[model samples]
Target: MNRSVVKRVVIGKPLKTRELGDQKINKLKALAILSSDALSSVAYGTEQILIVLAGIGFLAYWYSIPIAVGILVLLTALILSYRQIIYAYPKGGGAYIVSKKNLGENAGLIAGGSLLVDYILTVAVSISAGTDAITSAFPGLHGYNVPIACLLVLFITILNLRGITESASVLAYPVYLFVLALIILLGKGLWDVLNGQVPESLHTPIGTAVPGISLFLLLKAFSSGCSALTGVEAISNAVPSFKEPSAKNAVRTLTMMGIILAVLFSGITFLAFWYGISPKAEETVVSQIASTVFGRNFFYYFIQVTTALILVLAANTGFAAFPLLAVNLATDKYMPRIFTIRGDRLGYSNGIVTLGAASILLIILFEGHTEMLIPLYAVGVFIPFTLSQSGMIRKWAKEKPSGWQLKLSVNLVGALITFTVLIILFTTKFPQVWPVFVFLPIIVIIFHKINAHYNDVANQLRIEGAYRREKLKGNIVILPVAGITKVVENSLAYAETVGDTVIAVYVAFDRESEKKMEEKWNAYRPDIRLVTLHSQYRSLIRPLRRFIDVIEEKGEEHRNSVTVIVPQFITKKSWHNILHNQSSLLLKAHLLYRRNVIVTTVPYHLKK
Candidate 1:
């Protein structure tokens, strides 16, 4: 099969422009797709809290509920805050766009850098944690886990390249499955408590003390639990991906996501409290909770499997939003122009590939350790969250449309709250979060450089002076040909059209070859001078360049400028170009940088 045909098979047929409406998913599918990262965070969000609390022994476990409540309060305010964002910038005003427009370039770049790091870490940490879920169950295959995580990333990337809607379909079932399992566990545990059939595990003394709970410890636990908020911005960022009346659909998804995150996160924390589940070295808190609830039976395995599957698939959220963010950045010239090019599936193919490559590097660098990857997660997310919330405040105050005061107040609260959390996270996590600050400045500098390059290019390319019709510049066009073939004939034809004075130059390695070339040229008599030169060293570009210099040395009245019309022979297959030496490309590149010389390639595509 042809390569394109294979691609079509893998990604499905390309959708037409009008058919984009068909990709707008329903609310249930939207919830599963968009909310996966935030919802799946329950698997590790509670674990992260427990990890912090476990430092002071079992007594610290009680704080998990309170810390979770704090996180929940933030989640609710953030949900409402971002709902305003979705409506105001329904065209999908992610932090970068929102902040840049309202908060200025620096703030926007800050948000962009933060979101970029966060999305990449989302893929890395999500997959690593997902792999941990499996390894926690099996334990034997833990040694080969980094590679396993990378394979999972690759699988998701391929599915995303197929198109967002298709990726959502593939992701929906597993995500919903994970949700169902958790509900079953939470519901069953709650039922048992109400019916007065509480298990023995619930009496396992969660109040055991070492250092006990302290203010600093509670702050750390709260910050760890903020991982649940990592993907919250994704819905706002991807608002344009929603259906007709996009803002309405987006608000619906955002509300449902917020509610689901609250219920799952709250239930798990409560259940952990009820079951006396604490973090362990060998297994996770969720795993421990599952074992206690259902005694490690099939339902337990089902929960573990669904948990692993959803955690790995949580990367799908990054896969969806990162590319859309790239497209928006590219349109604003903060990124490369190539990022704007959509794939056959109406997706940003360049952005997807770049995201996948960046993710693979993160997975390898972190070596798939969830502990190493976790502390680095919150910083990236909160920066964007704060900046976006702050930007929303500006959006409301300036736009000040209907209900703008209330909207402004909500965003103000969200901004202050998220920013406070950010400050706490930075202070408590100064060591772990330092890399984010370092990497952020580096990325912001890159964005500046890209913007500078684009501006400089636009300045250079823009038509400055008044458009006056003048005779085209006087010129000598040189056609460099190897032999009297169709390619040469084509080049000469184009050269004649370009310049009044056209010359065909050929570099022959030996005198015999030079004589045969001159004889053949004379026999064809193409109404132009055929200049042939022999070389002892057989360096074609060097001799051809020297010949052009000799022509310029004349300083004749007609020799005002010179153009090198190089003939480019194109093979049918891209790989076929590798079979033959790229002499034409070499010659063109050779002439390209020379002062006062212009190069043009006349393509003669082969019919092979």
Candidate 2:
């Protein structure tokens, strides 16, 4: 049976199944899903500040509060802008949809590339940050950061594969508990500060300032704090994850997430400042604040546990966003088409696995160090931020009514602000974060180019009525045989089936092998016509290619009808395939250049 024919029969019509049930996610549930990644960032979002400030000495902790405030301002602006997105394009293309519809393919590609890189980094940073917290609890795991991070990535990937509703349901409690724990801790810290009974630092000399306070240090601290806003854009990508009235529900969810994040960020930053948190004096600002409030009591343990749990869940955001983005890109032909296909569970399995592998690699490369990866991180996030806002502005400009000038003016202002921030982010961070910023876009551009090339080739090969008119006037088939093997037998059989004049061509790379092969051919069959081409160059495809050209130039009648039947051995096990060669594939490609000739493969499968 022909494989293509069998495929057609097996896939006769699309099967209808209720795999994705009509479960409508309300605003709260949608918020849970969208905020899973961003909320989780509270676990180690300030890890960069602690690490960087520590390097600059303990006094830098004071600046962390102000920087966190700046980041909060940016986050608030982004949330407001994205509210418009949830209202406008609720189908969940996120930044990609916004840019593509309004700014063109290049802008869309830039947005897509940036978002993709950011998501991958989010996974790596989150998992590693979680590992850091875990290691703090159990110093025994200190040396296994990469292994633990990779395992966590795989674990998150599995949870995501269980389906969106399932993941959201399972994560809701932990995320809620995390929020509650932070609120309690922050409240306790403030009460202590107001009472003037602030817990003393473990190290009395910790508050001393370092010597330098350069612009570079400030930018570094800003970038570090910027990580808290990492997952704010997730809501934009998760528009479809909501139930009916997707846009309205998405906007509601977005609003909820914005409020929650704002409140949490403000509380956390305030507590850290009130307690005189120092990155140099502690590994994490949260940990430092925890120690100050709880004084190594049960409350401290509770904070550690919840913080770790939340950071681990931060990777969940990547787990969710990766698949949706993959589906969108695959639909646009930017990725393998298989990524676009949902599994029985209504999950993008291929996309999940791809994301998992990428995250693991990043985790290993940065050794799960979120601080080191933070500078490299925001470049991807803000590129999409700027372009998507610009896209939204363009949309409003073109679609808004004359009477709606006020609303359009707000969008224009948002776009300008976002664009300016994007410039500052890139200019400020790209030099230090050059590796990720420079490399990620290049990778996406390469993918775009490759996809474009495939599209162009596919267009050229698309058959029409005129294609048959250009077919060879006379029938000729070239069958390349190696030995008295099943592959050779299958090739001869298929050649006979073509109902045309056929030639069995063989190339002799060496005198000894050629002599042995010729003798064997004669001994096996004396009646068949065998044409041997000898090459001292030890090249197989080139000699066979030249022979076909010789046959073509003999006459137009000969050139008009040539069909090459190349026998390829197919093995079920990929490793077994390595034992064979790829000369047949090369020959088939070379034959395609000849005018009026068709190339077909006769595959001989090995028996198990």
Candidate 3:
């Protein structure tokens, strides 16, 4: 099938430009679509903390609740700070915009690069964690986790390419289901704890601590639990995707997402502690808790299914934010301009596909193990958190708007706290996360190079003073033909109209073909000059390029502009293209860079 037909089938028919406004969603649907990442982290975020603390002993797992509380405090700070961002910069560039305007270009690039890396990792990590849930429930499917994660990435990529509203509608139900499922699980678990019916911890007992809970271990656990805050900034980054009064609607959505996430994360961590759940090789803490509360029945299975779905859909948050972030960089010339172009469905299709591909690569590289991937996760995100909060402080200081002191204080505390967290996360996650620091600078350097190249092109292309025109003394058109055929005849006919001098040049590997071509050209009598060149090496491109070079050198004296028309036959079937030599294509590629030479392709379609 053709591209248009396939696209229509995949993403549905293309919507008109005017229909873009109709695609805007309300705060209700926005909560699910944009907040899935932060909300779903409750699945693994609590587990991550327990994983770290469990290293010391079973008693160290008690630290999970306190660390979760700390993460919630940070979440509250971030929500308030980003709400200010939504109102202040409604166009939604997120940290990149805030840093660029308030900090500097270099800081902005740093923030953008950090966020880009984090967003890509979000897809890989979320999908991997989701697949973990799957394997936890069905041990028979344990070995296929990487493949499962990759397929989930591809599915979400296609859904987002369908456009924002379409993806929101399809993904929103699962988020609600996940929330409802967890609420039911949490209620039952809490009731058991309160009524003195709490069962003993099901986890295998770890012996007494080798080294008791040190401040280092607590910081490590806290940093891991901070994954719960990954998607908090997504709503602020996507303010434009909401309905009228976009910023207000976006802030409302942010508030709702924050409250729901706080409740779910804290509840999950508390239940896991009470049940003495620990990360297992084959099961997640959430899965263990759910199985304990709901048993091996429908409710238990329901929670697992929704948990997997939400974790996979958490990549949707990255999908929503990464494209917009990329567009901001592209607009600033730090990225390729193609990322700025919206696809037929009005989504940043290039950015979406790029994220999906990167995520798949990461999943394959890490073998879809969430524990291995988690260490590399929080640093990229925290870098942005620190920079964005710092940038907001500067904004408040400079503008000094009404209630600027309160805004500045809010941002100031956020900056100091996030900066401290960033340091702790880095120190705790060193060596495993050292690669992120190395790559962060490389990404920033690449952005600088891209921007510099675009600026140089703009300078060269700028028509500053006046338009310059020079009258051409002569016009010469070179038509490369392989043999005497209808395709060549049609090309020669058009070539005659474009220039006063048209030369039909043929490259012949042997004398027989040359002699035959001369006779046929003489008989056809198209009234254009015929030049036949022999190549003993059987190289079509080399012979044709030499001929064009000679023509350009000779034409220089007469101020003549030269054009090369390559005649290529288009077969009915695309597969038939492989049967042909594609010599015309090669000739065009070779001649396109010659000064004062124009290359064109004239295609003659085949009927059968």
Put down candidate 3 lDDT per residue, 1-608, tens digits, no spaces.
99869888997776655576887889988999999998988888898788888788776776676688788888899999999989999999988899999999999999899889888988998888788777766889998998888889989999999999999999999999999999999999999888978855543333435456699988988988887788788888788889999999999999999899989999998888878787896777888999989899999989989999998899999999999999899999898876876776878888999999999998888788656656667777778788989999998899899999999999898998899888997798886788886888899998987787656544433333322222233379999887766677667667766777888898885688889999977776546689999875456787788898889888887888888998876766675454345667777777777768988888877654
- Runs in model 1 lying further than 4 Å from the true structure: 199-212, 465-599, 602-608
Question: Please, what is the whole-model Cα lDDT of each candidate in the order they appear?
Answer: 0.81, 0.72, 0.83
Query: In order, what is each prediction's RMSD in angstroms?
Result: 13.1, 14.7, 13.7
lDDT of 2 at 89: 81
Candidate 1: residue 402 lDDT (0-100): 90
How displaced is residue 397 in candidate 1, in Å?
2.6
Find the number of clashing residue pairs for candidate 1. 0
TM-score of each: 0.77, 0.70, 0.77
Tens digit per residue, CA lDDT, model 2, 350-431:
7888888998987777767766676666667777777888887788778875545655655566666556655656666666
Candidate 1 local Cα displacement, residue 563, angstroms: 14
Candidates 1 and 2 compared: the better one by lDDT is: 1
Worst 10 residues of 2 by lDDT: 464-473
Which residue pairs in candidate 1 have backbone atoms (N, alpha carbon, C) closer than 3 angstroms, thus clashing?
none
Compare the candidates by lDDT and give the number of the best one: 3
How much does candidate 2 score in TM-score?
0.70
- From the highest lDDT down, the ranking of the candidates is 3, 1, 2
